[model samples]
Target chain A: MSHQSKRIILKSFPQGHPKESDFEINTIEIKEDEVKDGQVLVKLLYVSVDPYLRYRMKQVDNKAFQGYKLNEPLTSICLARVISSKHGSLKEGDNVTSWNLTWQEFSIVKGEELNKLPSNDLPLSYYLHSLGMTGFTAYFGLLSVGEPKEGETVLVSAAAGAVGMLVGQIAKLKGCKALGIAGGKEKVEFVKSLGFDDCLDYKTVDNMDEAIKKFCPNGIDVYFDNVGSETLDAVLLNINDGARLPLCGSISNYNDTKEAQGPRRTFNLISKNAKMEGFLVSKYGKDFGKAQQEITEWLKQGKIKEQIDERNGMEKIVPSFIDLFHGRNTGKVVVKIADE
Target chain B: MSHQSKRIILKSFPQGHPKESDFEINTIEIKEDEVKDGQVLVKLLYVSVDPYLRYRMKQVDNKAFQGYKLNEPLTSICLARVISSKHGSLKEGDNVTSWNLTWQEFSIVKGEELNKLPSNDLPLSYYLHSLGMTGFTAYFGLLSVGEPKEGETVLVSAAAGAVGMLVGQIAKLKGCKALGIAGGKEKVEFVKSLGFDDCLDYKTVDNMDEAIKKFCPNGIDVYFDNVGSETLDAVLLNINDGARLPLCGSISNYNDTKEAQGPRRTFNLISKNAKMEGFLVSKYGKDFGKAQQEITEWLKQGKIKEQIDERNGMEKIVPSFIDLFHGRNTGKVVVKIADE
Candidate 1:
């Protein structure tokens, strides 16, 4: 059987904020005969739209991140349902997820690379969110790196984000004061609804340092930084002694064309005896199963809450991704390609 | 007996770099009777002139550091010899060192506050440098915070000064490649002679980022940051994956009156999965005995080297301290107050 599918490719590297023109859709034909042994033909169910994609669109020489190549299919770690498998373990209609899933209706991934989704009551779309990378990022970045202790304050920027919202909720569960920094009243309300002790609408503030100080009365002990730049500078100024900053993302600077200039208050962290560490969710792969199990339990008990802004159709992926940088979408922005 | 002791007092707060005009000598009488029970009259031997003292001269609201009050005697943790004692444990001629020792000819100190010096072949002034706070700063900052693994490259700034010189030698002793950044040819030569694999005279370099890359071909694993600002900004750009930055001091921004502005390259540390931590040796007091034992053995084994820039008399204290900011002194700048 022949399947006609379309995938998005990098047409041009973005100049500053990405435009839709930077990408182009290409039609491809996949055949059943091409599903070699040890390969599973997967039909991508939902594609995750995130800020990290902006980094891949850059022209960097460093090997830490290999920027997307021109005229190459865009790839992400997303949710997929296996259509047919040549491997003995996975049968037809088995749902699985893996890395480097292309932005297309169908993709041929190594069966060994696929993680079979367990039978659960949670939404299958959550396989791309709370039960996967988004949840794992919040788990390790908050628990391992941030190391929030009881009676301490954990402040998170972009508090209504996929990871940030979960971070604040987890900090509260750990017996720490949860404070948030969000944009506008709607996001602030959403973040506060997640049980954050306080949420600051940064769009309405003048002095971020003073604004943060007001919210984090006892001073921030652990800062889960998603949006960097001035927000980081403000957190550095308001941090208490022996503070730990888990550097999950730098979304604010990802769109910047020129080198960023800001007040050098990181020196303040030196005097207060604080630390800032950057991390990637991929590196914590071995511990993923345990984290995912715990998150699954939390979801089942309704101890934790999650939100997803779902857009339908393949064409909505890039547009939804663009919405993320403009602060137009809330929660985990996901594009549903097709129903199972 | 009555003794006329001259002590330095804070005449006024400094505007930029501290000048001799900012301090004045005040003559006061010290009687043997004033050395009451549990108190010892001690003669000052050597006073360590360090940059941290500059922080004490400022007028500040916070209690992390209390500024020296106007017309009040300046005090530092320094070397002294017992002249008269009313304490059970100490007698005349006992050598000791303690905190809050006034920069004067004679000071009455509580016996409980002093750490009695052990008998050793090394110079008494070694207590001020390698065996005291200076050595502890380098030891803990590099080993505990920086956490350099063997065969890894460790870079340090202000490489010819008190702490920097020891840091590089310790990195070498731990089986790591040591690199240094010094301001002048003389300081660079001194750092290299102390077993640093390479040294960059930063004053001679046009671009520090490119200059650092040339020395650290394998990329920097650990950076013991003494000089912050441009050099720190440069190190951030050239960092490898999993780099550790031990923020010991921000000497570059100490004198800046207004808020500082710089290139925000710290975001790069995120993609590289790096961490920067600040530390104080005081907090590591429990582990001090073990660290001191290791450092002493390294010194005796000729596995490590130290340099001391000794200035004679109490009058030289303020001048030598001022010399530090100007890069005039090459080693651990110390002022000898009296003969043994």
Candidate 2:
């Protein structure tokens, strides 16, 4: 097992959009032979670049972010393979995903925080994608919070992106008319091909309200929101009675230093008997496998597709994460850290 | 049976706050022998003066304000007694309530909307209060939407006033420690005596968040919100995890021509996985009787107490409605159109 590890640490917190100046990559030496009992040495195969990670960089007293201490390695969901294990139940050559590991290589993790991935005749990347946090987020945010029903119209913002595409596909499987709002013609075509009934290029639309009304004549019944700004405001006005809004992530406002521009149609929630809730996938750890089983089957059956925008090598990791904020990456953004 | 009747008609739509100029009093001759088969002449006794009626005064394309056509009589819920009945189901001298019927000395009402008062001994005013729309709003907002649990903290803004008072009492009955926010010292004392664990005079408070924290150290579980400006912002900061906020009304900014200036905290719903929903009592009219039965039983057994701010004469109706915005009325505001 490799003892020394190279990891990215936050040198300082950025004001809004995280600058490269905020991060410092360093190689730390670890004595592998000094590995204590109940700990496994893992080689991180893939690291996730999520919008939520940007929130963790900010020091806010919020449940979603337990303040990211300065000069520390930022952590989210990382898929790692246990190369050598001293833990009771773990073994060598085991694939496990942990929500507590890093943006680094050679992570030492506790056994309790790790879950052994099931063996399937699918790509190992699916464990970090369609059958992972992104897929489970779509399931819980739509079913538990959004409470989507069959025959209802669902409008998803960032619909061609990783979580959004999965949300639209899952909602379609539930018999809902899925509408996607993306940034460009390519992403719009991409989401439409992924099974959304209609895909709108928000960049091309002059009037969002008219564009939304054209797609949802009966009004939006369920809103799976990933982008919350003017898009949320537009969706709010077209909501029907008893509409449910699941706040997945607000990538649109992640970089705003001050409060984001106030949404124009926030009062619509009161008038329409609508409700909006925010949730993190960590809250659904108990029921992850239940969603994983369904998502895995869908992936295996080709009912749900996986699209990864994989950047090569550990050197490209920071740029891949930064590209997420600039809307450059489509589908799941993962950095291939090392060989499988 | 009287052949003459007096009615109030809307001469024009109100530009802002409704004034005496917006309405006209008129007398019409009713043919006593021409009464329809399912119709009864009801002599009006009590007319409810609600804040929602003010919203109806401003012409708008909303369900609450369906925009009155010129020179038509304005109508709302009125507790009345059958003066004469051509309908076999209702006899003369029966106490009843109906949403239909003109604001007048006498008006004809169909049998469908009319409900005879419960024969069990209770104040006739209770029909306008703890047994009617006010009760249903509290029951559904607190029990169903707010979802209060025993020992969990419940906060009601405008607590001593109308729906807030009933909601606090109901929360108390459900074993929650209830807190109320009222305008004056008297109203705070009044709600305190009604079994609320604590009451804050929001008018006198220097910092409402500090005051609320003093009352609810465990953090807020359910917030029955009728005032939706700054108070809601304070509640947003104090909400516990998985809190439910049922937005009953926003009397605070109902009359403002401009959007109210307050900290918008819809984003807080995401961090706490909290839910905020706006509701109308009519949406749950199907279960009104079920809720009314429980409230009436409690009222009859002296398990709950109530207060009514009664103003005599139909001409005083405008003042009664205005009192709601001023937070001067406690419990229910009822206009005594005539002595029974």
Best by TM-score: 1
Ignoring the other chain, what TM-score does chain B have in each prediction?
Answer: 0.98, 0.94
Q: What is the per-residue lDDT of model 1 for residues A1-340, given as tens digits with 9 covering 90 to 100?
A: 8789989999999999999999998889988779999998989898998899888888887565657899999988788888889988998888887766889888887899888999877898888888889999999999999999999999998889899999999999899999998999999999989899889999999987788777777778999999888888888878899999999888888889898774378777667888988888777889999999999998998989989989998888899999989889778988999897
Model 2, span A194-268: residue lDDT tens? 989999899998988788878689999999989887788778879999999998888888888887654545556
Each candidate structure's TM-score, on Cα atoms with residue i matched to residue i, is 0.97, 0.96
Model 2, which residues run further than 4 Å from truth? A1-4, A261-267, B1-4, B259-263
* lDDT (0 to 1) per candidate: 0.87, 0.82
Reported per model, the fraction of native interface contacts reproduced equals 0.66, 0.41
Clashing pairs in model 1, backbone N/Cα/C closer than 3 A: none
- List DockQ, one per candidate, in order: 0.65, 0.48
Q: What's the lDDT for candidate 2?
A: 0.82
Single out the weakest 10-residue window by summed lDDT for candidate 2 chain A.
Answer: A260-269
